[model samples]
Every structure is written in structure tokens, then in C-alpha cells.
Target: MRVFVAGATGVIGSRLVPLLLSTGHDVIGLARSQDAGAGLERLGADVVHADALDHAAMRHAVRVAAPDAVVHLLTAIPARIDPRRLSRDFAQTNRLRTQGTINLVDAAAQTGAKRVITLGSASVYEPNGPDPATEDVPFWHRPPKEFIPVLDALRELEALTAEAGGLVLRVGHLYGPGTIYARNGSFLHQVQSRNVPIVGQGTGTFSFTHIDDAARAIVAALETTADGALNVVDDEPAQVGEWLPVLADLLDVPPPVHIPVQMARSAFGSWGVAFMTELRGADNTNAKRVLDWSPKYPSWRQGFEAELAHPGSP
Candidate 1:
């Protein structure tokens, strides 16, 4: 199969191109810069220069690739977030999820692409529901003010993909070499410096995924005829109170301090407070069954120890 990938220079895309190539698939990556094009070339992927938001350019690029499958990985999320300015930070990413998806899906349809796969967020599920949210669970009915627009964008993204009979991989919090959870990434800096604190009971649950596993799942989805959505997460769902302290311990840093919910809201905004207190974890049963894929690091505990604690130690 000839695969066309948008956001080909991104964390997952960089890893995915090589995987697709190794599996004997011809990969064509959309790049916005010469540097990114060069990088994709080094990975043995053909490069097409086009911005995902530019409908004309994106359509032309996809048509030129004439791909059998299209994979959308476009996003502009920052390494570190400013809680107070959450909406501002996510504005571009929201655009990418909305318009970027439209452009790609439309192009795929034009070129008769058979399979279309795009990324989604597992965290969008309503937190008030079950402990482990499934694909059947609805998106948050009452999300935080900052997240309302984000969820709206996600809804648009998923709806568009589903209309095209494509698969939406709602990935969990990604942690690997290029993600914020990497050893030297911004998330670790926040942990090592004791910047992130536990809010209230810290009852919120988090489902995590290794970067390699995320790429593998995409590869699996390419061969499967499964449409609709799948929650691509790990086996274990951990609470904030449990994982934060464990991560601090692994990094030999001070445990996160606990603060009241009110203080947390003032410090980290409503979304931040809700994230630490009310967020629910996602279940990956559907994803595993649909794609016939399993995570390499089945738990964040093993992922953190291997990637964050002892990277390249052998």
C-alpha cells in the first residue's frame, strides 16, 4: 500500500513513517518546511510540501501521492501548557483537528483512498461516568470552559472521519522519546521541580500509552477494516495521587504537594483543577480487539521506568 501522512514530522509521524516503510508500504509524507522534508527523506519517505490547513495545497498533495491510505497526525500542542491561557494554547490545534481533518478526508475521497485513519483524544470522555470509559461513553456533557471549544473541535474531527468510513484512534496520554513525558521533556522538568501538585483528593484517573505502541496501533489499523473509533490506551488506569508520587520517586524528586481544590483552581484554572480531580480513564478493549494490537509497555509504571528513569542504559 502507498500511504500518505499529514504532519509527517510530528512525534508519532516520525516514528510511523519508518514503521510503514519497513512493512513494505510506500510512504509519502506532507511536510511544511525543508528541514522537515529533509528529515522525512532521511527516513526513506517521499515528501510533499503542503500546509494541512490549505485546502488547495493539501488536495493537490494527496492527489499527487495517489495513496491507498491516508493518515492524519496534524497537531500543534505545546510542550508545556499555561493553565490560565489554555484556550489560546489550543486554538491552533483545534483548527488543525477541524479544518485539517476536513481537508485530508475530502482529498482522500477525491483520490479514492481506501483507508483513512486520524488521531483523537481519549481524555475527552465525560469524567462523571464509569471508572474506565469505553468507546460507547459520550464526550463530556459539561466540560470546563477552556475545554468546550476543544471538545467541539474533536466532535467535528470525529464526525468528519466517520462520515468517510475512517477509523479514529482516541489515544491516551502519550509518553515516549518525543512527548512531554520523555526523560528530558517538559513534563519531567515540572515533576523534578515540584511544579505539579495534587489537587484535593487527586481522584482523577489517567490512561497512558507509549509512543511506539501508538505507532504500532496505527499500523495495525491500516490493515483492519474497522471503522468508527477505538480507545488506544494501556492496561492500567492510575489515579493522579498514585502516579504523581510514583513518578517523583522514580526521578528521585520530592513528592508533589497536596492543595485544596479552591487553591488549585486559582493556580491552575478550572480545567487544570478538573483534570486533576475529575478526569476519567479510557478502556482499550475495543482497540485491542479491533486492531489485534497490544501495547509494548502495558503499564505506565513500566514505561516510565524504562523511558524516563533509565533511557539508553541497556
Candidate 2:
């Protein structure tokens, strides 16, 4: 299969290009800069220099590539985030999820692409649920204001993808080399700096995925005819209190400090507190059954160790 990947130089796309090439797929990647284009060429992907936000250019590129499948991995998240500026920080990424997805999907459709796969976040699910969220669960009816754009963009992206018979992989909190959860990454720094504190009961559960596992799921999606949404998370869904100390241990850092719920809200805003105290985990059972995909790092516990062992891992 010939595949065109937007965000080809991104965290997941960088890993995915080599994997796709190894699997006998001809890959074409969108590159916005000369360096990115050169890097993709080095990795054996034919490079198309275009930004995902440029609809006309993307359509032209896709038409030129004439790929059998299109993959969207575009996002603009920074390596580090200040909790107080969550909404400001996510504005560009929100646009990428909503507008960038629209452009890519449209481009793919225009080019007669048969299949499309795009990334989605599991964090859009509602909070404090007893059961982990399956793909069928509804998004939060009233998400915090700061997260409204993020959720709205995801909804739009998913709707567009589903209408086009594309696959939307609702991935979990990603942790691995080049991800925020890496030893040298933002989350680790936050932990080391004591900015990521355990709040209240610290009961909000999160599903996690290693970068390699997430990329593998993308590879699996390419072959499967499964359309619409699938949750691509690991086996375990753990609470903040459960994972934080373990993460601290893996990084050889002190356990995260505890804060009262009110203090957390004041410090990190309501969204941050909600994420720590109420967000639900994702269930990946359907992905495993339908895509025949299983996570290489089935749990963050083992994933963390592997991440730390890798030299200069993100």
C-alpha cells in the first residue's frame, strides 16, 4: 500500500515511517521545511513539502502522491506546559485537531484515498466514572471551559473521519521515547519540580500507551477495514495516586507532593484538578479484538523502565 502521512516529522510519524517502509509500504510524508523533507527522504519516505494547514497544497500533494491510505498525526503540543496556561497552550493544537484534520481528510477524499487513520485523545471522555470508558461512551457533557475547544475539535475531527469512513484511534496518554512521559520530557520535569502534585483522593484514572505501541496500532489500522473510532490504550487503567509514585520511583525522584483539592484547583485551574481527581480511563479491548493489536508496553510500569533505559529518550 502507498501511504501519505501528514505530520511525518512528528513524534509518532517519525517512528511510523520506518515501520511502514519495513512492512513493504511505500510512504510519502508531508514536510514543511527542508530539514524535515531531507529527514523523511533519509528514512525512505518520498517527501512532499507542504504544511497541513494549507488546504490547497495538501490536496495537491495528496493528489500527486495518490496514496492508497492517508494518515493524520498532526498536532502542535509543546514539550512542556504550564498548568495555568493550559487553554493558551492548546490553542494551536486545537486548530490542528479541528481544522488540520478537516483539511487532511478533505484532501484524502479528493485524491480517492481508500482509507484514513487519525489520532484522537482519550481525555475527552467524562470524569469520575466507575467503569473505564469504551469507544462507545459519550464525551463529557460539560467539560471545563479551558478544555472546551479541545473537546469540540475532537468531536469535529471524529465526525468528519466517520462520515468519510476513516478510522479514529482514540489514543491514551502517550508515554515513551519522544513523548512527554520520557525521562527528559516535560512530565518528568514536572514531577521533578513538584509541579504535578497528587490532588485530593488522586483517584482520576488514566490509560497510557507507549509511543511504539501507539505507532504499531497505526500500522494495524492500515490493514484493518475497521472504520469509525477505536480506543488504543494499554491493559491497565490506573489512578493518579497509583501511577505517580511508581513514576517517581522509576525516575528515582521523590514521590509527588499532595495538595488539597481546592489548592490544586487554585494552582492548576479546574481542568487540571479535574484531570487529577475525576478523569476516566480508556479501555482498549475492542482495539485488541478488532485490530489484532496488543501493546508492547502493556503497562506504564514496564514502559517507564524501558523509557529510562533508552539514552536521550524524550
Candidate 3:
């Protein structure tokens, strides 16, 4: 299969490129910079220089690549993205999800692409909603105030992707060695350096996945021609309270000091506070059954420990 990957140098993209190459699939990755292209080149991928927002350029790039399967890995969040700007930057990110997705799907359709697989997020779900949200679970538009509009945009993006038989992957929070959350110690840095303080009871449940595992799921779905929304998460959902101190221990740092949610909200604002204080998790049954997938890491703790040992992490 010939695969075209947008954001081919990103956290998941970096891992994905090599996986596709090893699978004997020809890959053409979209690179926004020469440095980004370099990684793809080294990974044995043909590189296409084009931004996701530029539809005309993207159209040409896709046409030239003529991929049998188009994988949309494009996202605004980088390995070092600021947590404070999530709400502000996510509006444009939402545009990328809605409009950029439309562009990618349309371009794929024009190029006679067989399948389209795009990344989605579990953050759109409400804080403290369900234990494990399924593909059949109802997504509350009013929940997770900061990410609400973004979820709405995903709804829009999925509607468009559905028109062209593209698959929408609603994955949990991505934390791995190459990701912003892990790079340069990242959230792990804050924890190791005693920077990420605990809030309230810190019992809010959440989910996570390894970048490689995410790539595997995407590849599996593409290979099987699986369509619609699937939750690409781990075997178990973990709570902040339990995971934090464990993570701290792993980094040889002190256990985090707890602060009230109200106080933390006043400090980190609603966007940060919601994820830290409130929680949403996803189920992986559909992915296992349909995509024939299984996560290499069963939970965040296991994944992070391995990633922390990796060279890229601090």
C-alpha cells in the first residue's frame, strides 16, 4: 500500500513512518520544514512540502504522491507545546480538524485513495463523565468547556470524513518519549522538578497511549479498512492521584503536593484545571475487535516508564 502521512515528523508520525516502511508500504509524508522532512527521509519516506492549511498545495502534493491510503496526522500541538495556550491555540487547531480534514479527505478522494485515517482526541469528552467512553457513548457537547468547540469541530470533521469513508480515531491523551508531554522531561519534567502540583483529591480518571501503539492502531485500522470513530487507548484507565506519585517515584521526585481544584483553577485557569481536576476515559474494545489491535503498553504508567528510559526523554 502507498500511504501519505501529514505531520509525518510529529510524535506519532515519527513512529508511524518507520512502521509503514517496515510493513512494505510506500510512504509519502507531508513536511512543513526541511528539518521535519529530514526525519521522514531518514525513515525512508518520500517527503512532500506542504502545510495542512494550504488546500491547493496539499491537493497537488497528494496527487503527486498518489497514495492508496492517506493518513492525516497533522496537528498544531508540537512536542513542546505550552499547556496554557491550549484553549487559545486549539481554536485554530479546531479549524485544522474541520477544514484541514475536509481538504485532506477531498484530496484523497480526488487521488483515488482507498482509505483515510485521521487522528481524533478523547479530551473532547466531559470531565468526570463516563468510566470508559465507547464509540457508541454519547459525546456531550457542553462538557469540557475549554475543548467543547474543538469537539464540535471533530464532529464536523467526522461528518466530512464519513462522506468519503475516512476513519476517525478518538484517541486518549498521548504521552511518550518523543511527545511534548515527555520531551525535555515535559510534564514529567514538572513532576521530576516538583513543578506539576497536585489539585483536589487528584482522583480524576483518565487514559493514555504510547505513540508507537497509536501508530500501530492507525496502521491496523487502515489495513483492515475500518471506518468511523474508534477509541485508541490502553487496556486500563488510570487516576491522577495514583499515577502522579507513581510517576514521581519513577523520576525519583517527591510526591506532588495537593491543592484544591478551586485554587488550581484560579492558578492554571479552567483549561488546565479541567484535565487535572475533572476526568474522561475511553474504552479500547472496538479497536481490538475491529482493528485487531492491542496496545504495547497496557496503561499510562507502563508506557511512561518505558518512554522515560528512551533517549529522547529527559
lDDT measured at residue 180 in model 3 versus the true structure, 0 to 100: 53
- Pitting candidate 1 against candidate 2, the one with the higher TM-score is 1
Q: Taking the tens digit of each residue's C-alpha lDDT, what string does model 2 give over 59-103?
A: 888999999999999999989876567788888988888878888
lDDT of 3 by residue, 1-314 (tens): 99999878877888888888999999999988999888788878899898788889889999999999998877775434444566566777787888898889989999999999988876556556546777776666455456667668888888887888888888888877566557464666677678677788876677887888899998898778777889999988877888888878877778999988888887777767767766767888988999889999887777777766564542
In Å, residue 71's CA in model 2 sits off its true spot by: 0.4
| TM-score per model over all chains | 0.98, 0.97, 0.92
Model 1 clash tally, residue pairs: 0
RMSD of each: 1.1, 1.4, 2.2
Give lDDT: candidate 2, residue 136.
82
Superposed Cα deviation of residue 292, candidate 1 (Å): 0.6
Ranking by lDDT: 1, 2, 3
Going through the candidates in the order shown, the clash numbers are: 0, 0, 2
Single out the weakest 10-residue window by summed lDDT for candidate 1. Answer: 305-314
lDDT of 3: 0.80
- The local distance difference test score of each candidate is 0.92, 0.87, 0.80
Which candidate number would show the highest lDDT if scored against the true structure?
1
lDDT of 1 by residue, 1-314 (tens): 99999977888887899999999999999999998899899888999999899999989999999999999999999989887788899999999999999999999999999999999989888886656999999999998899888999999999999999999999999988888888878988998889999999889899998878889999999999999999999999989999999999998988999999999899999999998998889999999898999999899999889986788531
Q: Using TM-score as the measure, what is the rank order of every candidate, best first?
A: 1, 2, 3
Quote model 3's TM-score: 0.92
